[model samples]
Target: MPASLTIQLVNQSTSENVYAYITGLAIQHGMARVFLKADGTSLYFPGPPPAGKILQPLTENCAIPLGPPGNTVTATIPQMAGGRIWFSVDDKLTFLRNPGGPGGGAALVEPSVLNPSDPNADVDFAFCEFTLNNDQLFANISYVDFVPRLPIALTLQTHGGAVQHVSGMPPDGLDKPQTVLRINTQSAHGTLKGTVPAASPNQLVIGGEAFARPTTADILGCNSGPFATGGGGGASAVRNAIIPRLAAAFQRGCVAAADVSEHPSHPETFYRAGGPANHYARIVHECNLDGKGYAFAYDDVQPDGGEDQSGKVNAGDPRVLVVAVGGGGAPVRITSTFTFGNTSMIKLAEVA
Candidate 1:
């Protein structure tokens, strides 16, 4: 892969203040916390602040504005790991610099949806995750956090004439008011009543293995209690992998223990009637035109040859990465034609 990737951001919303922010650990630069400068080409590495919890303004303007609706902005990004492209609608997001980070590097204080006091709390925003390295470029649209108002789509054009696309939510998919299906918790609990261990109400024995059931909050967060994957061995290791599958199974109401133990199971084996299903996830997946994107923490777990349900696009020889945001209207379309050695051709078209 190239040292840097070309990213084109297209604003498909009516708002003229759409802004994009890119942040990641520069793999070629000592894995320092890096952000794309306002120029959209240069890199900015922030210095460590004196203390923690105090929000310090960035020394450099890193917010790359996308101009008005129907406008497209181009940016260059270096090889980075754990990278994110954040977009805000009608507002500029607040990203602060703080102390106490890995390798003595500064920690980035990003916008948060859970924090009510966060400066970007009222802002409408979303992001996509990616990792570009010497091997390949892996990118995916995530909904691990709360869903955003804006929709995002991805298109990857590779050098081998292969194109991979993830069609996210349509411009008005979620915004349109409509009656939605709701999952009944009582029905879901009844399905797992048989798995409850006689000795422990908080634990369920499935396939002769005891698994701790997380709280309602923990299930939603996938971060605490039984969902937490603490570093260790023995049962912890076993829980690390099986717990997620079990949680997914319970929510999806998988009938057989074999279906829960065997990951990446066929999609048809999940979310059956008379079973407890993650209704939010089911609705989110249905909202997306391609029926892709992460609806839950374990949504990516699939059978070896099973089709991928997560919305992801990746390539070893990525030519261009186009990200469409603010799905307010018809999405734009771009096409390119090229040859290997002697000749090449490129074309761009926007469909209204």
Candidate 2:
């Protein structure tokens, strides 16, 4: 590759004088080619230096007027292909004169160093991000590694509360709301887990329909209860009985008994007593079977101490639940403070 050099002349004696000195330096260095720009203007070199000799100006005492009233000339030398040389004006008094001798002007000569009285010869640099890899194969691999070529999969799990559209609303009342999903990898490799809430009923409304009508068995599905009832009867009875039973199940230590009325509008009587007043119902859920895992629970009952009526999990409520893959690598567990919701859902491979 041919070498090139760049020199910035701040207040050189004269643009011509500065050009003459720079040309001499380039010839002395035996550079393949030389390019000089002063105040954005190009300088021309008439001819190449003789065999091994450099060309220097005849006059030694050349004075470049100081810039403005106080400013002096400054020069900056940037990296060049073959070698490096920089010149600047300092004190504005010292001068370079032709050294008379046999090979006089033809003799190989060292370029005069110009020191400027001013300190404005600033060297600017453009920075860019780059990677240095010793192995050629590994170098290419590094470039492709961080470029997120393949999509990422994330799994979310819910616990403690039933997935409903909103408090007091049926799971099928509204469309599913968007939830935040994040995957945080701390080390090279490790299990990932997080929790999503199940307070919104929309979570259970699959394809615009409820997964199943409220039934004793289905309601108990949220919890691991052997005594849970079975689903049967009209829509109203099924809906009324199933939801309370699901709530009752989450109310741990409580036994639920129902009385079915023949009335089509009000079909069932759900009665339960147990568990903490605030810990009424829960729904456990999981998603993202690919690899990244998250789990969370929702609570249907509000704590007695707070005036807030929202059934969503409170910031520090003990009833707020969590689920994660077991050490044995078995299916994740959906734990609850009381009973689980019948309308829990698991999103599969949703995050990317």
Best by lDDT: 1
Q: TM-scores, in order shown?
A: 0.52, 0.16
State the displacement of the C-alpha of residue 214, model 1, in Å, after optimal TM-score superposition: 26
* Candidate 1 collision pairs: 171-327, 264-302, 264-303, 265-303, 293-311
lDDT digits (tens) for residues 1-352 of candidate 1: 9999999999987899999999999999989999999889999888887654457878889889999999999999999999999999988999888886555777889999888799998888999999999999999999898667788889999999999999888785343321221111222221122256557965655444565755456666666666676665545444555556555654454524243434335677676653446778877877886777798887776655668887877899986666767763224455767676886645657775
Cα lDDT computed for each candidate against the true fold: 0.74, 0.27
Model number with the top TM-score: 1
lDDT of 2: 0.27
Tell me the tens digit of each residue's lDDT in model 2 across 201-289. 42333212233323233333443232233546433333333333334323321221223211111111212232122222222111323
TM-score for candidate 1, please give it.
0.52
